[model samples]
Target: MTFYVCIKRVGDILLSLTAIFILSPVLLVSALLLLCTGEHLVLYRQRRVGKNYRPFNIYKFVTMRSDSEKSGTITAKNDPRVLPVGRVLRKTKINELPQLFNILFGHMSVVGPRPLVRSEVDMYPEDLRQIVYADNQPGLTGMGSLFFRNEDDLLAATGKEPATAYREDIMPIKGALEAWYRDHKGFVVDCKIVVLTAWAVLHPGSAPVIESFRNAPGFPEKELTDYRTLLARTE
Candidate 1:
């Protein structure tokens, strides 16, 4: 295993265990609520990219009706598949808890690239494919997740095809962040991203980097400031 991957395995396992211990009560309650509401599975899995250009199933709490991916991979915040409580979980960033196991398994990092679903993986550019696969391990959180944190809502607001926005706008930005991560990979930067991620989860309004991709150094951000303006004026 790679150095970070090995470290990730230990860290993720410990973190998963600790989180499970601390949150088991909430997990149980959440599970029962889902069951009572006929939500079925309390855990859900999907094919995601991981270290060395391989595919692995990623874990998440079941936040959507089963077969939620029967259509396409992009999730609009208003997606009918999202269960009521799922929305809260997703919004709170709690839905991603199960990924701790992925970290433990050494297939991911506490900070790295967000694992893309197989459906979305092809959207990555040819240049970035090798860059990501070199490390192969995905992350529980990463640069892409930080930048596109409001993506689902953006899609919902656009009323355009989610695929179009993803391919044209979101994926390009994601590619840029990944390239940055590839060039700047290190423990300290990972730490920064982790802290930034916590802030993002707690107060998404503080996402200054996401606000202006135009100034983000990598993305073609001319139109994004316009979106930011709309969000600010409306807010």
Candidate 2:
């Protein structure tokens, strides 16, 4: 690995460990709540494509019914599979805290492209499929995660089937955003993404986050315009 890559890995370890230590109480409470509710499962582990196309199980607090995937993998606004407590967890993004462990274990980075299920990875434009995961480890959050922060709402606004809309619209944009991150990957950019992710949790739909990286490489302008139009309909 290059010097900066080594530094980033070290940073991921320190930050993830520190986060886990500081957030232990919240993590414990979230686990207990999940155990008592929603299929009585504490952690939900799903297989995801990680660095260099390696597959690993990603951890999250159980936020949906056990049988949720039978209906579809794509979750949209007010998805019925979501439990009552899940809404809070998902809304506050507490459900994803378990992924700190993924970062600590070196399966992911503090900032890079968010990992995707194998199927979702396949949905990327063929040209981008090899490019996205080849250079760096997948992340707990990244440009795609930030830009599509309200993805569930956006999918709902499409007025089309969730999976269909995602495949045709969101996936391509996500691929482009990930590609942008690949090109712009660096210490400062990663730090900015980490800050933006935290801000997104506190203030969803904040315009500053969108403005932060408006000049991303291969940014799909027409598609983004259509997405903004769709989001406007919901408001």
Candidate 3:
């Protein structure tokens, strides 16, 4: 795991710096649009669970109304706080590009479980903590993220009860997916996930990545069972 972390860290740092150069125009445009909308801040920093379950402020280019956290951490599709450009950023996953900086600083990786906010981390089922954030750094892109690319819409569609649906429906599947990544950590699998992420963002389709997950092995049975329990309840 340490070797993986070392490899992942160096890989991410180089890539993040390169990403910043290539995506400068997009970031500038996003920042300007956010300003015009009176969103003010160009970046949003929020506390998220990190390696060793430590809390750290994760950075993201601000995409919603300032003070959006007054409502909550999770963003549902059509969330009123979403700025005009924010929607585009979210759709293209451009919003996450800045976190490459996080990777450079050792707060994130190119592949691993997406970090959860402290509040949400506390809500995670304690019994499953080991599998949830066990190995691999929380990454810029990951299996769970690939699986739930449309999550904001799903949560929003829950309508007046976003919290309930998120807690019982959305969260559990993410847990299963992340736990799958945790136990199956390896370079080949990691590279495959990163490739899937790129394909998903660039192509905006489900075919390739969906097939990959369906074929992936070593996803913990307990996690899948827990996921089913949640799905059954949600249904």
Best by TM-score: 2
Which digits, one per residue and each the tens of the lDDT, describe model 3 over residues 154-192? 565555477777776676667767777778878898889
The candidate with the higher TM-score, 1 or 2, is 2
What TM-score would candidate 2 get against the native?
0.94
- All candidates' lDDT scores? 0.71, 0.85, 0.74
Provide the TM-score for each candidate, comma-separated: 0.83, 0.94, 0.87
Give the backbone clash total of model 3: 0
Query: Model 1 shows how many backbone clashes?
Result: 4
All candidates in order of lDDT, best leading: 2, 3, 1
Ranking by TM-score: 2, 3, 1
Alpha-carbon RMSD of each model: 3.4, 1.6, 3.2
Q: Quick one: best lDDT, which candidate? A: 2
Off by over 4 Å in 1: 1-9, 157-159, 208-235
Give per-residue CA lDDT, model 1, range 1-235, as digits (tens). 5786566567667877787789888777876766776466788888887877788889888888887778877787678888888898888777887787776666677777888876677887766666764654588888777766777866555556889867766666577677777766677767777777777777776345564333434443544554454345324
